[model samples]
Target: MKKIYFLIALFCTVLLHSQERYFLNSDTRLYTSPNTSSAFLGYFRYGAEVRLLSESQNGWYKVQADNFNEGYIQEKFAATRLNAKDVKIKDAENPILEGGDAYYGGNHLFVLVAGLKARALPDKNSKIKEILFTGDPVAVDYVPVNEDDWVNINGNFDEEYARYTLRKFIGLRPNFETLIKDFDNLDVNAVSERKTLSERIVELAWNSEYSKLEPAYQRYYEVVKQINDPKLIAETEMNMALAKGLAKHKLPEQIIAFTKKAEFSLKGTKTKSLYLSQTELVKTFGKPAKKANVGDECGIYLSDLFYYYPDLEVSVDEKKNQAEIVKVYINENNKFIINPNTILDNSVSEKAFIEKYGTYIEASLKSPHNYSIIMEDSQFRLVFKDGKLFSVEIFFYC
Candidate 1:
């Protein structure tokens, strides 16, 4: 009995320690106690692994850094997982240097990954110049690429230029303090600047691969929380919540609940509601760009007319005087917004779609030639072609 109790106690201790381990999301100071006023023990860099010594106290975490230096750090600055790909580059408006005539002189990027290698050339096999850690700054010559392309650092080069993967860099350097101050003062310029920054952040989050979507949105959420706008804050919260659900491939019932809670507004189409008459739609959006008889193509007995718009296509049944179905094409000019906050466009990958909406109900038989997938619920259907979102179909019920 005594031996069993001892082994049980040892197992519990090991499990507790394993569950408490976390990584620093940002550079944070280690305090001697849970209070900020307490004496400073040391500082931990981003991506530093630490073990929680105790439960959170007043939003502070009792952490043991380096398995020895026990201290307290703010809970918000720590994450269960490392987010090395959440890097951001300084925008043109907020340049690294105040003045420079050179085109790429002011461009600067932040390293999000710990131990990111800086190679002598663009190739992965090239000699490594140095290893960069999270939050490390690097000035560049031009705008960083969005894909797995490489960019040359400003000063880390010699006869051969030093390069790093561009996908690891975000586009804007957010200054939350300045933004809050400007917002409080009702600065118009600041509002415009922040809008641009927000758009860039949203683009980055939306374009991220399915595997990285959570961290990308999490980083965006952190930025959104600093802004002094209630509407934007609410929208961000909705987006984050929806993203979490989608990333997990939630069930139809759960998705319904999420959509109901979000109460997303339809901004792309002229009509406010999906259940609108042809006359109402025309009154709101004027004449369609093109009108076609699609009844025969659809094999529908009723006389159906398909009205094509820049952002949407509506199939109206003449017998009912109501739209039977509405289709939104996901393209470069993605003006159609079924969900304004969670916009899906051509940039979204098929893998991302599968990850978000779960398995497809139907797929194109002619593979290697023309590939497509169809995922449907009661009201909405998503169609993907060639590993990209092609269109979203909305069905109307009587």
Candidate 2:
């Protein structure tokens, strides 16, 4: 019975670890302990998605990032109030609002702004039917005529006499801090290989010309900005800038050149990385665990050869498939993860990287933003572009 009780406790711990939460404040700091001056565990951006851990005080809350880095944050940065008295929104200059363009689309949505009044129609003049608070999830029956107009939302029959409401205060329910997955953006080359919604959207936004992104991303960003993390705000600005740059460099080649010159990406998390000479490249990944795809179509100008391992893969360009530049890719099944500590989760976000490793490579800050890195004490190397983990390589140097 004692063992059974322990198993129940373990199950409860996992359940708490999986419960999604949000960093309601921008740049909320997570500390190693409950004290404000304790060691800084990590910094969370505005509206950054997190998980609620063990119960805590009214002033402090235990939390965890997607990376599984556990810490504590202040409570004020975590609460969402929807009451008319506590709902704080940027009041429009005009006290009254008008109807938005007619929308005919359908989907479940949420209320972004607190104290939003439910109306009979999409227009403000429509009779007020009910009141909605912040964090309230709803459904929408229509799409706005203009992409930026007020969205029409549905009411819950579960609520007393609840019906449809229309105003600019509504939002699509956020699946935590995720963005754009519903828009069909995925790195589906591998099974269930996924990126954080923010990373996915930012990636497409960075390479907008080659990306098929929806305008709805703009609307989504606006809603998420409420949490006001500086990191997210900067990315949003960069997205707009990339879109503008696309107009200047309309040609494909020119756009690529412009992007290379205009944008520089950062590593999401630093992992132990190492440099391989042409000889080392051939000797290491060349030992394939099973079969590897080798051909011109598989690599640089079809000139590079690639090797596959149970937990890792590497590609090199040379006379054979051995190229001077080598690229390594790692996924959940990569053989390098020889243990639980090396667990490679589907990731593009640095926070995820930091969470899983329990320690981030601070020295990686010195490495070139786009190159592969091997930490001084690490057995594997990670490569990131535009702040997302594109691949990881494992090798033995020790």
Among these predicted structures, which one has the highest TM-score? 1
Tell me the deviation in Å of residue 311 in model 2. 9.8
Clashes found in each candidate (C-alpha, N, C closer than 3 A): 1, 26
lDDT of 2 by residue, 273-339 (tens): 2233336544544555654455554233223355545444445444553332233454442222323
Per-model TM-score versus the true fold: 0.27, 0.22
| lDDT of candidate 1 over 208-251, digit per residue (tens) | 33433455456555556656678767556645544554465545
- Root-mean-square deviation (CA) per prediction: 21.5, 23.5
* Regions of candidate 2 where Cα sits further than 4 Å from its true position: 1-235, 255-280, 283-305, 309-326, 329-398
The lDDT for every candidate, in the order shown, is: 0.53, 0.44
